[model samples]
Target: MTSDAQVLAAIINALGAPKKIPSHPPKYRRAAVAIIIRIRPDHGRSSAHSSKRRHRQQPQPQAQPRQQTSLSKQPPHAEQPSCLDEIVHPESLDEFFAQTWVQSGVFEILFIERANKRAGDHRWTGHVALPGGKQASPDEDDQETAARETAEEIGLDLADPALFRCVGQLDDRELWTSFGRDFLMVLAPFVYLQLTPKSPPLKPQPDQVASVHWQPLSLFLDRLAHPQWTPMVINLSNKLAPRISRTILRPLFGTMALHSIEMPYKPEFILRYQQELVKDTDMHEKAHPCSFSHSHPPYPPAKTRTVAMIDHYPDWDPGHRPLRLWGLTLQMVADLLELKDGPIQPDIRHKVWDSHRMRKRLDAGHLPGFSQADMHFWVRALLKFHSWQQTEKNKPSESNRVGSWESYYRMVKQAFVFVVLGRATAIAVLVRMLRAPMFRMIQSSVPSVRHSKLLK
Candidate 1:
């Protein structure tokens, strides 16, 4: 059994060596998200109290007066300390985790449920995601974008040296449409660790974040705690394709099957909107034109109204839905987990051709949220497509002309349809040719006079 400290060490080590992607053309957009990690006291642990007591017992150091240097004496272009420099060193991290109080704590990661869509933009609305947004002009770099977005969305400032430190970052990922046609943006994930024993109170911006949650990292690593993937069906009719294209392709592709992970633990909401937190049972009746009653809500009813009222709710639920990890956010989590646990096998390149073998490999490895059959196809397609992209990217002249994985997947889909239709047509022609000879033989078996009369 691995300790939480060991797991975190492995993650930090992985983040130290990130697979970075080069900046894309001006046409392509970029975004960044922060994966914030913190160790909180367990249900019965007194770590926070103990830490407070220890702080109170320690003697305070007297403040020293600052000596201002002359402007001429100071060196020009002196480099300032970065957030990365403030990160906990390996030796310090080990010492911190070695403490009894810190060892008893639970490792947790922060997540946020996005607010409802305004009008035209509906992407990631009400989705459980890491705190982040697109890159802005003021941001110094990609990592800065992550820190800025995190601070803007949730009031936990990653840049605050006293509270948090930049652990490192994960590999950059390119987002694509469901149909694999258009490229969306590149997503860069940065990891941060809380230096303090206790987490700071978070103030979620109501417009951006509907609620905030702290999910245990153990839930993602344990197979029994987090069950296998559940099917999330997508309607093809609601896609952005043209009506004529949809009509022609409806028979071949009317619906798409995706997978979602049902979070086992009930999320602890740090900050939530008032309307989402409460259930107004009498508000509907009071608002009705025919009703003229003014009733006061019961205390117990208000107390019992919580997010956990619905048991095992589906992902497609309209309002007050449970936290279901899926889509891009889930993929990011899996990527981090993969770093800690290592790959499923020494090499999965040969196994991509065999779906069953690959699925078995993923299952044996106990990879959370990736055991479904639907996911297997996608996993294989992406592996092959990425391999191809890498080959193309390496070529000198073709590197500039290389397309995204989406375009490659679309081409493969079109080819598959043509292959299926071509085979069907060939089989039909062969069957007709074979039946013609049998018909002639039956005609010969009939008497000459009867055959002639039938023909006439």
Candidate 2:
């Protein structure tokens, strides 16, 4: 049987070999992330790998004392070599099964969600992203950037090469931002195995981070794991009634983009809340806040207003609460898992491309342009049409409340606060500007008073 040390050594050796690294253009922005792996002891003895190892290591009964045969003389049995012979062979080492090793034992990686979520162009905000950021000048290279960002973001200091071993680099992929900042961003993913099994408590940077997630590596390797479709409705209703109505349907005035998302089920790595006694009912002390009780229905069920103000949303399956993973993060994970095709379904890719082309066409004036006045007219028309439809059906639409008196009152209160704040800011600026000049004038008058005193 191969010792655990031998298994780890084999992996380290395979990672040391040169890989076919992809080249990127200089104009593209470069970023890096560490695929941190924590190898745990394999507890499942029934696994094929474990069974094979057991079968190979089983002791064989000593050959029965050879009896002299009357007619035949059999050649003495060839000396048998240790199983470790194959593992130590240089050629066999080259063909070593990395997937078997990685998938054999229980392992997991770290993922983080960004805070201060921004909307529109920067749709990736608030999404689950690997602990990484854009490269800085202080970073000597992409690897350094990945290590430094990991330390800053998750408090994992990979700077010491002795602690973390680079498993190998994954193929580089380029992401050209279509919405927010128009630029080409390149991703360089570096896979790393934590040499030290016992890691320190993670201290995630709060301002830049919303939460930390530990994802099991097995989830990625699961072929059955598929991506979920998300509907993103871009509000193109000019600047007047922006964020009014959104739908997957091609808007006569707005745009609808379908974003491909893959949110795998929660792995065993993430710690769940422990059930505790609380007064009467059994309660979990650390329940997931975003999740709800089994009996209670999710509030504002998305289906209730699919075509209303909240058009941009994801389709969550029952018991499949997603972590909102999409965009570049999805691509990186797919690559790390050695997925031949990318994470997004091929058909979904076509739809997304079509949406992008549609957006481009609208921007190019291929469609009728909408003025701010036209947007306002559409807003009122939509409100009236929806109201009339509800009356005809004799049913109350939840979306109707978006533009109701209560909503208007809230809007008015927000506007009043904004006005008050704006006026106060302007007054403060004006006072600051006058104070400097008034101080100078007072200094000049003080000189005149000093002259008068000298004459006295």
Using TM-score as the measure, which candidate wins? Answer: 1
Candidate 1 per-residue lDDT, tens place, 33-135, comes to 9999887755344444445555788798677545554455666633221112122433466665655445666788888888755757777676889999999
C-alpha RMSD between model 1 and the true structure: 14.2
- Candidate 2 per-residue lDDT, tens place, 42-125, comes to 434214554575568888666565675423564443222222212222233234333233334456677776765333445444
Clashes of 2: 1
In candidate 2, the residue pairs with backbone N, CA or C atoms under 3 Å apart (3 or more residues apart, or in different chains) clash, namely 121-180
Model 2 gets an lDDT of 0.49
> What CA RMSD would you report for each candidate?
14.2, 24.4
Q: How far out, in Å, is residue 230 in model 2?
A: 4.9
How many clashing residue pairs appear in each of the predictions shown?
0, 1
